[model samples]
Target: MTPRKGERPPVPEPLPAPVVDAHTHLDACGAKDAADVSTMLDRAESAGVDRVITVADDLASARWAAEASTWDSRVFAAVAIHPTRTAEFTDADKAEIERLAQQPRVVAVGETGLDYYWDYSPPAAQHEAFRWHIDLAKRVGKPLMIHDRDAHADILKVLTEEGAPETVVFHCFSGDLEFAKACVERGFVLSFAGPVTFRNAAPLREAAAFTPADQLLVETDAPFLTPHPFRGRPNEPYCAAYTLRDLAALRGDDVAELASAVSGTADRVFRLRTVTSDLPNGEGLR
Candidate 1:
């Protein structure tokens, strides 16, 4: 959970097609400066990980993600106060996040939701902040990205009660098939991370299989949850190729088809408009 060694994992081979690292902390992934962000994108692109949504966990990060989205064409942003940081979530913080949500490049209004795995923030505060973010997402007309830890039922309850935004994605989804069904029925997208590629991640694999191609997504959650073989090493967007490959094998699906579906879903959900050469003449921004 700390430094993943100065020497990060080598970038794997390119995927059959490009995909999105739906949720990653580029600023926290040894990419603190603008140059670092650009270099990271260059590396990611080489592996067919052409686009990324660098997410922010706190106010400072929210600002950085907003700015970073503008630095490189391939990078977009997701702004939020992570649940652990929700204890300090204030009116001012909410106001700023609301402002950031309106930015063109800030595609999603979260990575915000319930997290009972830690006691850094009390449940009451978490609930209140979660509701605020849900409302914020609705008001701003952006997708809501959730960070659900061990609080599945409560997360679902809050979304149901407050009413969800037009688009909702459970970043680093850790739910079982039943919970997965609940989210899908509500039109929520489940994003599979490196954990889905593990031998012991049968529950997650089941959820992946149950998730329709249209409702399915994948992420690196980079600098953490690196997929198997590279499990505890370190992660980056390029490694999303590994997870995509494994997911295809797990579900008995075609890799190229899966890649196309995931990338297309991300472009649609996040409203990415990367002006990269990867796009044919007047092809994307969907």
Candidate 2:
């Protein structure tokens, strides 16, 4: 039977089932309202993205991300001051972040690290703020999510000197093969993002191939860095399939197996065990 003229069209068939988006920013994305949030989650859920770790780079966004986590079992929160915004970091801000980190839904302590590309904040300040975040992660016994952009040496030095939490994740890892080897040797997880799917990102693809099985993860870094075939458009958590496919190709591994492995890595690093039942689909929650 034909549908009514005012009736809504059926949703598209969902992507492959049981995919996990290791990193994203649900609150900062298009989900500014309850309806928008629900729609976004529905899109992701329909795409087989069972879970996402929504990250916030500032206090206000952190609160929003935390609240979003409460609104949906599929969402989790990662809070910290982005390196570019280090000027806004203060003791009180740290306190608030620490408090949020103690919350049941908060997973990791970053999206924080050095960003020499913009240099929005002084390098020294970025380093100082990064150290403080590392300390906070240690104090709370949570993993650290690092963001390194054109500051690989400095990042390595800081992590080696100040010492990172037991679990350190280098999100959107774009480093060279040597850096990838070093990170693997140090037992740090390297999370590949949309850039890895670019044709010109051969170096990143090489790094992706070098990441050890247990130390590899995948993310969308959404609303930005949309993977190939979808570049130049706003990214979303549901687009993580591109990254997973690229990583699997680079490593010559089965896509399904790699996807499941990275999901497990994310689960362990983010302490998803404590919040599995609260997660959607009963997959990769712990």
Candidate 3:
């Protein structure tokens, strides 16, 4: 059945092998509590997105994201004050993020980098916060997930200047082939999102094709950037299956092979763990 205007695109068929939604925003996707989180993951699981990393964009969301990870084994958390939201970033906020970064279910310190497209936060503040998050990721021994927008040069320069963490992910990577090559050279993982499937994103497609399999990952960045044939409609983690399948077709790779590569890359970069009922809940988080 055809989806009508304003309706979400139907869930795509499951991948031959499960893949991770490398980055998403469950809180923004209307996941208000544990039950909502479970429901969202259930949908994602049905579509072959067996796990997700819910990223935080602000203090409240950061807190919520951390707690939400504890609600489900399939959901991991990445805590940070988004670059655009750093205008009034406080020390207390930094302290809390640091505390949350240590949580067992919190997989990375991320979605933190530059967004030159928006004027919501001053460049100076964003730079300062980016540096701090970089340091935090390094200190916590976790991958640093970046949110680079129109500031590719600055993002690379800053990471170089501050010394990048052991593992760095360009979350929802939006760059041309040149930028992709540069990130590839630095061993930085590029996580493609729904926009890569857009009609106008030829350069993005080229970049995605160019990224090495080991450094390649896929994501939804949910509630935004819904894939082609569904652009402008609301997005959710389940939509990752659509993006992954599209990526396979575009790159001329076998769906199962590419899905396996992406899943392994996510596992390596994020150091993901399968959450079990016996595992401590929200351990080491204050």
Candidate 4:
């Protein structure tokens, strides 16, 4: 239909492209309403972020993420009780988590681990909850997405003692280079986030530089830790491009190539079967 006088023209359609965002909190990013989620996904799609794994750290958010996924093709959900929120977990929580793990759209078992920096929950409770989540991951035969903040040693010790699922990912990895090496050695995938693009994040950048291509992944961790150019702004999936650029620079590879590599790693770790591209290693991104 032709527009009337003084009417603005319609926006051109965005080019269809494939990109994967390894981590983000869909429910925590003001997407609590259906309209908000639709708008958020629309922006993501316009920016070429084809798929995103929405991580929920508690039962309420988990249910929200799962329900949101059912409404958006590009959204998938990961449910777990975050370390900080572990104090809220009860026996009912455990049962609910087990039942949620069986859902088709729910792919991984966390955003769960130890966070010493913010002792929102007691250390002992965090430890117990962390182990329980790990056990749940093993029982469900799914990958685990872990969050470690200033508790790398404890996290490593727990993973070693209790053993992680076959597919374990250190999401938004902020550890030192030594820990990065340790994680790779332990067969854990390290998912870098916007922090890697920060000027003072030398340790994170160093870890990014040395991580094996196959063991590396990328995420946005949106609504927090937005990359340099957008550091103080509200982060979203599109900002992952800056992270991709930084990672490619760190590895001295093409941006598209690095994106392909991390996308493949994410697909494998998340058990996604319909990714949009293939890795340089000749493996399907899925």
For model 1, residues 149-206, the per-residue Cα lDDT tens digits are 9999999899889988999999999988999999999999899999999999888889
All candidates' lDDT scores? Answer: 0.87, 0.81, 0.91, 0.80
**What is the lDDT, from 0 to 100, of the residue 241 in candidate 4?**
68
When sorted by lDDT, best at the front, the candidate numbers are 3, 1, 2, 4
Residue-wise lDDT of candidate 2 within 94-196, one digit each (tens)? 8888888877788889889999999589999999999999998999888899999999999999998998789899998989899899889999999888999
TM-score of each: 0.93, 0.90, 0.95, 0.88
Candidate 3, residue 256: lDDT:
96
Candidate 1's C-alpha runs over 4 A off are 1-6, 274-286
The candidate that achieves the highest TM-score relative to the unseen native structure? 3
lDDT, residue 158, candidate 1: 94
The TM-score between candidate 3 and the true structure equals 0.95
Cα lDDT tens digits, model 3, 1-286, are 6666678778777889999999999999999998899998998999999999999999899889988887787888999999999999899999999998988778899889999999999999999999999999999998999999899999999999999999999999999999999999999999999999997999999999999999999999999999988998999999999999899999999999999999999988887854333255645322
Per-prediction RMSD in angstroms?
A: 4.3, 5.4, 2.5, 7.6
Highest lDDT, which number? 3
Model 1: how far is 42 from its true place, Å?
Answer: 1.2
Stretches of candidate 3 off by over 4 Å are: 274-286
